[model samples]
Target: MKSIKTKHRIIKAVSALTALVLASGMLAGCGGSSDKDSEGRTIISVGSWPPEESDALTAMNERKARFEEANPDVVIEPDEWAFDRQTFYAKAAGGQLPTVYLSGFTEMPEIINSGYSSDITEALKNNGLEGMFNENIMDIISRDGKIYAFPTMSYVLGLAYNVDAFEAAGLMKEDGTPMQPANWDEMVDFAVKIKEATGKPGIVLPTADRSGGWIFSAIAWSFGVEFMEKGEDGKWQAKFDSPEAAQALQFIKDLKWKYDLLPASTIINAEDWYRSFAVGDGAMTVVAGDYPRRVAKYGMTPDQSGIMAIPAGPAKHVTLLGGEVMCIKNDATPDQIDASVRWLKTRYNNELTDEYKTNTETTTENAKKDGQLVGIQSLSPWSDKAESLVWYRDYIEQNANCNLNHVKLYNDFVADCPAEIKPEEPVC
Candidate 1:
């Protein structure tokens, strides 16, 4: 998860009318510009939302500087415009989109169908990156043989838990390691033990908005439920109303209503829940691989936390894969589109070139200097499974900042998990 800090302060609740006015003001200011600068260089904006003092923000600035040096005719504009559901469409319709914007893999179909993204098939082919992407992920941005965006990163849902709390609860094995639960029942039992022993909430399950549904889909899929399935006619239809889905929902409801495994609030968004977990308020929660970076910002050390694969269900284990895609605005000129693609390749997709190796080395060295974790395992969008594994091996060997044993369970799980990986829901 990307860390975007928000300040908390006590204030009187706003009246309904005032709230509406505030919302209107927010929507009214969603526009951005893409005109040439005084120097006559085409301005190509990129979207990022890194915390002020984070290594990520520093890396992004460095990349922007390098991009500008390489493409002097184009000026790189750094926009702090992270993806927001409420303002996205308004910005797109107003021609205020950054030249390159980040979007969830699940949002591509809707963005493409709504004519918000440019067709980048020819651009990718021209750059020889058409065949570089993992086919499974490429399909997320491709429709009828036209590509709309480039997949930048991919992730799977997993169980993030506090090691100290688990040990206090005697949830660890005799070998001084976490006790890996094999199924949903064992997981619930373990959560109960952690709560009884630590006097803290057993687990936090986000039940608020789209995130609740997203995490629930992972559980539902693990329960052998396919929320949406392709019919014989090749059209997608909702299948979430099945018994398996009911079982999954019941499990979550039991955590809150019956088991009292969650907090009293009963509804928590992703950021709030992650904060709760980071501060050691809860023992476990569902999260992606990059969650540790967020936890670190909250003062949690690497040894204090660990991640494991989602527990197996009655049928088998499955994980829902999701990630971000880099897209160009539909209104971009041909030159702007080419420059955007070139920027993307230089920054993210240069893995096959010698420049990429040098870049990787430099990034690892810099991360070491900045005290950043170098080799946290994550799914790749540009390479197939085999190639990704090879890349990861070399990367960890040269760049790992933490002990691999800290997340050994997660590593083992990813290595042994079934190949039947499921993608996010296709219906936008």
Candidate 2:
């Protein structure tokens, strides 16, 4: 195993931030009225609160306490109301949404057009966060030159593999690094090698719950396939049926039939894919950037995980970029909006403020204690010059518990041969 204390080289900062923990930056608790409780402080309800028995709840509460102590006149009422497409509109229509809540980046346009969220342009400017965001991220949460949400984090897709499986298959380099696939073609050969040596499915592709289409899109993009484009009249056009898409789909078919590299089962969803990869039944899977918490839950040790760039195709290399944003409810009062901004800043500010330090320290300590893996690749919504980025890197390095070689491999790619980042297109 690689030393956890190995010095991590300074890599080019990617577009995402390391997901400190799933429940850390986005804090929510039991849903409640967005009004003053027993006290006179203005209540700002927010979502993504951990369950009562979760270790994360204690961390959330600690953050809540610190936030309350800092902003005495504002109170934060946590909620567990995660965004669900099916239930969101009903909640919005019933005026039951939290003052500030986590939402998908793609949902912003709909939420804004439907008047379900507040325009926080002025609030962002007021809080010294106006210039922190990457412009591409700004576009996602903005409409008509006004900002409505704050992008907390972003991620790109990559090939996450079982380190031990690759070694068992004699796929490791002399320097103890995994022999990562460089292109889709090489991925096939590598899959065959792993299967022949380890007697396990070499790679898994998700096929159920629409993830089959989702994964295929990335592979298609690598093969130089554009799924959609605007016509001369400005109407959107579908282009996914091109010959390149057929080639990509054919590759998947060959994996199952010609190569016999995929699992025997015909059905595999995102959940099953992660489970397979975690247990080494499937040696590799496409994973969104960051340490995979779900894989860890399925019993994979930190030392067993490794991530590399998504294999390129004939035309180019690309990865899908996506993240979560914080949206304020449309009807929130000025005080509520201002309070929400203050609260959000604590989660994603560029300055090395006391609040930021406390939040990071608390989250890191709690994650360490919870038997979680620390330090993985991520993209940040903030600019490259965000001062706190340096602090965060040092902190993670000092406290990292995972095998640093894996982190080095992923970060080295981000710093060296980073894939072209493409934002996800909206579904019509």
> TM-score for every candidate vs. truth?
0.74, 0.81
Q: For residues 1-428, what per-residue lDDT tens digits would candidate 1 score against the true structure?
A: 11112111111122344466677785343334345677878778888646487878888888788778988988887788888777787667656678899999888877887788999889887977768876657678888989999888888777888888898898866554577777778888988999889888888878878878888777877777877777899667887778887887888889878988887787798877877887778888888877866666667765677777778787668787899999999999887888889898887753555666666678667655543445556666765533434765677755566655556677666655553567788772
Clashes in model 1: which pairs? none
Residue-level lDDT of model 2, residues 225-314, one tens digit each, is 888787899556888878998898898899899999888886998888788888888898887765467777777777787787888889
Instruction: List runs of model 1 lying over 4 Å from the truth.
Output: 1-43, 47-62, 77-82, 94-96, 168-177, 193-200, 224-239, 256-260, 263-265, 352-375, 384-393, 397-403, 426-428
CA error at residue 401 for candidate 1, angstroms: 5.2
Over the full model, what C-alpha lDDT does candidate 2 score relative to the true structure?
A: 0.77
lDDT (Cα atoms) of all candidates against the true structure: 0.75, 0.77
Off by over 4 Å in 2: 1-41, 51-54, 228-239, 353-355, 358-362, 365-372, 415-417
The TM-score of predicted model 2 comes to: 0.81
lDDT of 2 at 352: 86
